[model samples]
Target: MGRGAGAEGSWPKTARAALSGAGGRGDGGGWDVTVGGFWCTARPSGAPPLPERGWQLRVSAAPAAGEAVLSAVVRVLAADPCGFRFAAGQECLSVLDSGTDEPGSTGAFITVHPADDAQFQRLAAELDRATAGLPGPVLPADRPYRAGSRVHYRYGAFAPPAEPGDDGEHRPVPRRPGGERGEDARGRSYRTPGRGRLPFGASGAEAVTAAGATAGATAGPGTAAGSGAAAAAARRRRGGALPAGRYAVTAVVRQCAQGGVFLGREASGGAEVVVKQARAHPAAGRAGADARDALRHEAALLARLAGQGVAPRAVELIEQEDSVFLVQERIAGQPLDGWVAARLRRDDGPGVDWAEAGPVAHGLLDLVERVHAQRLVLRGLSPGNVMVRPDGTLRLVGLGLAVETGRPAGPAGTPGYRAPEHGPGRLAPARSRVADPAVDLYALGGLLFLLATGHDPLLPEDLPRARPVPERLGRWLALAARTGGTARRLAPVVLGLRAEQPRQRWGTARVRAALREDSPGRTDATRPGGNPGTASRSDAAGPSAVPPRPRLGGPRRRPAPAPPAVRRSPSDTTGVSGA
Candidate 1:
């Protein structure tokens, strides 16, 4: 295919040559086009001469493959090439009769100015064919892409756009008559099951209210306030909002710039699930990959750790239009922070009782060991990402920020839980730092401190501060008074783990040893700083220490000769008292 400067702009020579059929099509084909980036943006109305031409494609390739696609499109339509304007990487494509071109600040793309409806249809069809096999869906040239089956919005908000002359009251979009179903890209049929349809354009809050009214009407008066909460979860076995109509969104758990996390239920089964939506090009970047790539990474990680009981199990990944959704098992627990706060509230004391906190601390330690054993660093290990079950077991959630050991660490993670080395902080530059297990260990220390005292180390008055500082006598004394020796006993361990320098932080082996020694079952001699002499006295006074006495008048048999003691190494503590 020959190339020329079309309406968009001068095409890149490299991109033109790459698509000139010089490289064959197929794996070995010389399809060596380097795509700098690809995205879509809204086009201004009126200038395009057609209302349907409201969006345009942005493609940045060294050889300018976008122009080649546009060229093919024009040839197929038998349209004039001047009607189109192309922008190579970071350049704007000028609009006809417009004062200025759309800014190319967000990257390069091709803009088409179709003169009529016939040209618009031809353009959309050709562009879709040209980019059909790309990573994401063929966008801009096609109609707006909806994420899930029933919901119109990509983030699973039930609000549909209000119809004209509706007086601003939110209303559900009417489904086609006959309860017709539609198929997704995967050719699976799906439809909304219930009579109540979601309002596609309503505000998120309104959409949430509609969903609650649909599902939470049966909840009692006591639960009326929390009816919209995720706790009122149930599964549907049929049609719903998600692809294949397999899951229906009940509540949106969290929403952020990246995307929203929804509490959904299985359409076929009654199990509750969590659906995490990832937009195509999230505002926030993750190691250069888009939110979709990050969600895929998280799904793979969850699959790898499945059945370990430390992380949520991956269910399935659904790709709809320009968004990706990850459906995972909904953990039946509360956030670690809330769990701690609830215990603190119930107790009359300033901090949680050590009896209640110790088990949680140990469970967290075990979880860390399991994750480290897999060579995965829980980069975002904050209390908010941890879930504590009623049975006292712990599970880690939100593994999107996790990275493999030795991978380049990015400026992602909770501020208070992040370590110094993984920084764009005073100690290190923001970039070029590699992931290390010590980062998680550092967070673990802060987490333990939170459990012990119900106060985050990030607080100004906490003993083990998130930032590095010289150990202050006053801070230690304050911690002792608050935790009543529970946190005091673990102060050295926490200090070692939270050391500003990664190398000075305690390793897994040392932490395990310290925790084992301080276990509740250990005797005085085995406890740290316990008096060794008191061990024999405690043992003699204990029920297990005294020998059994003859019960009857019958002559008591002489005590059997004691067995010979076997010498053992220091490491062999089996059957030995306080070895």
Candidate 2:
């Protein structure tokens, strides 16, 4: 029979009643059963309005009786719906099975494409009533199977083919996917087996599991299909955004070279969330795999760091067809740069005053120390990676790039904030270039310099003058330009932390001790109250200060090799709390 025009008035009364089982496919006395009366639509949550003359229903009968029922449904449902007057590939249906196959009995699965919500409700009511009369158990209508879960299908006895008519020809039946007629060696007509086999069991009946073929499959309900960047792109072309799964994009947060960052709202709950997407390079090969691997690594690290409270909580890692999405809890604060700008915008001009920024600097260090205590390294510690909370306290975010200490490091922090060891022409051999706690300390020192001088330490103009400040006992001339007691008090410790050689730099324990005045490591001499004109003979060559005898390439006192497992926390005296 030709497919209908989809208008209710044009639908034959007999066809409508047949759908309700007045003379259902079961009544036709065939093993292949046709279950109808399901109603769904192509509209995803928050999707734009479908095109005019949007959707239509099409029917696909099994090529022959006793075919795999699950395969038939998939091929039918996945078939081009546009041929029946629907908006081509734009339409999709959410199928729910109401069949009860107990022992020797079998039933059917219902596929629906309702025009609207009211229509869906009505169709669901009628389905429940119709299935109730059958001896099989009644499956609830609204309880559609979840995506990525399994389902079982059972085929009935096969019916014999219809006899040839007076024309001596049997009715034509469509071939299974990839099955075709070919000539045998004898030139006799023969059928070649298709590429795929029926994933069935030994018995006439077999369980057919639906691998992420449900309504929510778009958000990756199945086992990950190998970095689904291509699938994500297809969905974006169909709809303007990624497929609806758990979170729905609400607003664009920011756009970058990698991809776009968006603010999304959870579908189950209206809570606000942040969604960051990264699109793979269009070039298909090793490059695509590398991009996917990078994205996956970032998601995994952020997920692990989420518990440590220093980074944003990782809500979900969604791998779309052509992109990867990382959904995180919305952090209610601005970037460190924004906070600094706002502070300086107030009557205070140019540089960040030490009084206002010193505590913030301490808070950031304390947090980083906490992260290091967990045996993790904060590889990205630039101003862009830090945030100032509503309470004026500091919290670090973007742990996506952080890796375990001692692991071979990937790329380092943005330009000026990274340590010299992480910069070009490092003294350490490439094989021994593992990340260390010293890098974190070095970045913290650069941050201190920026907060004090309102300038990056590595800026080309300042590099010439800043190179000598690290070795000098006097206040850094750049920091001295701001001229505050707080600045002077902070200068010595900053220099100690920013030392070119990791071995000469102060450990977290030493820095904390200096801040608390509990250390005899020149803290007293470095304080503004102590003599500053000429450094104390002991101060200039102390272990925490400049080494008594400077060495080329590395420190005079080489640090012991790190442990094979977790490296010792930088703060050996007092342990910092974990995330």
Best candidate, lDDT: 1
1-579, model 2: which lDDT tens digit per residue? 111234122112322232233222222321122222222122122323332221111221111111222233222222211111111110111111111112111112223343443433443344333332121111111112222111211111111234466899884332222544221111011111232222222121111112112222322221111126644543343343442467766654443223446666787888877776654431112122333456577678776666666776778777776457777777666666556655553255334776688688778778877788878888778776776677767666666567788897644776777876677555655633676777788788777766654556653333445545365422232224333434444565677677776666666665666666533224643544554332421122112333222332456366423211211122211000111
Instruction: Compose the digit string of candidate 1's lDDT tens values, residues 402-493.
Output: 78887887655666577766655545554327777878888887787676556666534444444224243224324343435455445545
Q: What is the Cα-based lDDT of residue 265 in candidate 2?
A: 79
Give each model's whole-structure lDDT: 0.48, 0.44
TM-score attained by model 2: 0.47
Q: Which regions of candidate 2 fall more than 4 Å away from where they truly are? A: 1-240, 254-258, 281-289, 345-350, 425-432, 461-482, 518-579
Q: In candidate 2, how many Å is residue 326 off?
A: 1.1
